[model samples]
Target: MRLSLEQIIRYQTEGYLIVENVCSHAELQPVIEEIASEIDKRADRLFAEGKLAELYKDEPFERRYSLLHRQCPEIGRGFDIAGYLGDEIFKLLCNKNLIDLVECLLGSEISCNPIQHLRAKHPARGSADGSSAPDYFQNVPWHQDCAVTSEDSEASEIITFWMPLVDATAETGCMEVMPHVFKLGYLNHQAEGGTMIVPEKLPQVEPVLAECPKGSLVIMNKYTPHRGISNRSDIIRWSIDLRYHKTGANSGRSFQPSFPVRSSSDTGSVLRDPDVWRTLWREAANGAGRKIHRV
Candidate 1:
């Protein structure tokens, strides 16, 4: 599953590349099933606590959360179970096909950054004032991934892989990126709308929509300016964003843990125990209150 020369060239020239069918539905079934189970568990708990009237057991995975939110707006506040890296998620992170493509661009040595996250962008609820409710996670503003980290990792070449668990269409808030903006280097970013590029610094180039189907991968350079669109559809737009860089590179957020997924030079360093990955996340969560390096 290494990228073709044409694909490599396009990535280098355009700052991003869309690799279709990188992983099949069967390959992603584990994570998808795990997520659905988690949602069911949450729904059950909410129902027991009287926050929800019905379990909505018959609803599909994409619509379950949205329907739950409609029943109880507060349901959206605590449904984020992505912080924990379960066995399924760990397996997906080290998927052979995915790492092969990563090795093509980042050499044989690879380290999975701790900045990964699984996003369940629910539909925006319209307010009585004729405006959509504020959706901090779904409607991301334009910003480079590099700008979200500390200056110490500016030299690291981190490649972000955005994979959708469901079809990411224009209506469902697919990613939008400014073409070739990686060549411009890091742009001045502010805290406005999720550490976005300053409006004055935005390039004149038109943004390109990264409409991806389920199991497709959208790879982007760390310096590329991109943002998630506002999900207006009825179903939740489920996706996962993972980051990888060369082994031993400064992971801008050094306070968090990173694990080596593959090492050609020193195979012993490659993480073989899923428990180690789980423990690392647990420790990070326990110490989350400490001072963390912010962009």
Candidate 2:
């Protein structure tokens, strides 16, 4: 989990680093199983409502959602699962390996940014020939994480970890990033299908596909310009995008609460109770509405 000097340097030089096997299957199983359970519940409900003919009970986690979406395209758009701030998810957020790698970059004091999401990118039937038929959510446009954040956090050094539950290949809409663009700082982004870097301002560098195996992580800075491609494969791409930054630093969006995950200086401040962590998100979810720049 602790990154080597070369890995740290690579992240600094290229704006991203793919850390293979940062976590083991044992460490990831709980989170994966929790997601699979949620999928099963949804599948049952859809089946009862006559939306899905078969539950695909024997299908694996990677294929279940895609199969469900294939049978009922109407269920695709609303399939994105939020409220993942459960106990299992919190355990993954505080994973020692992940935290150690993050500490190497952001120091010992770490705050878990609230702008995290578990993305289940279903298969797109459309051709990969630059077609517009792909669902907007399946194919994310080019954009920097910082661009989607509030303006006040422009200077914050937020480290993002993109970890896939299944093997993510180019065919499965693995992330692609423009090398060394983080050094250039935040770029102008506009809302297309999603918040994206302006077409004219996109980096000219050839994008590198971040193909990663299950339990691996693609770590990037807030300014890294990256996007997910359309999932042309048959299976759904299950990935979690989590963010962390130095404790007490701005979390981009002040409206959402960021909890201390690791704090050597103030050990008592570290969140140990999963219920408390879940409550933080529950309060935010129930609080007054604010316009958030969706990524």
CA deviation > 4 Å runs, candidate 1: 73-82, 125-133, 285-287, 290-295
Question: Residue-wise lDDT of candidate 2 within 120-179, one digit each (tens)?
Answer: 877776634222234764778888888757788877899899999889999888999888
Q: Where in model 2 is the C-alpha error above 4 Å? A: 72-84, 126-134, 285-288
**Tens digit per residue, CA lDDT, model 1, 1-295:** 8999999999999999999998999999989898787777777878989999987788888777767766777666544434445788889899988999999899999999877878887777662213243568477888888876778898999999999999998988899998898999988988756688899999989999999999999999998999888787777789998999998899877878889999999999999788988777677653356433244
* CA lDDT for candidate 1: 0.83
Decoy 2 TM-score against native:
0.91
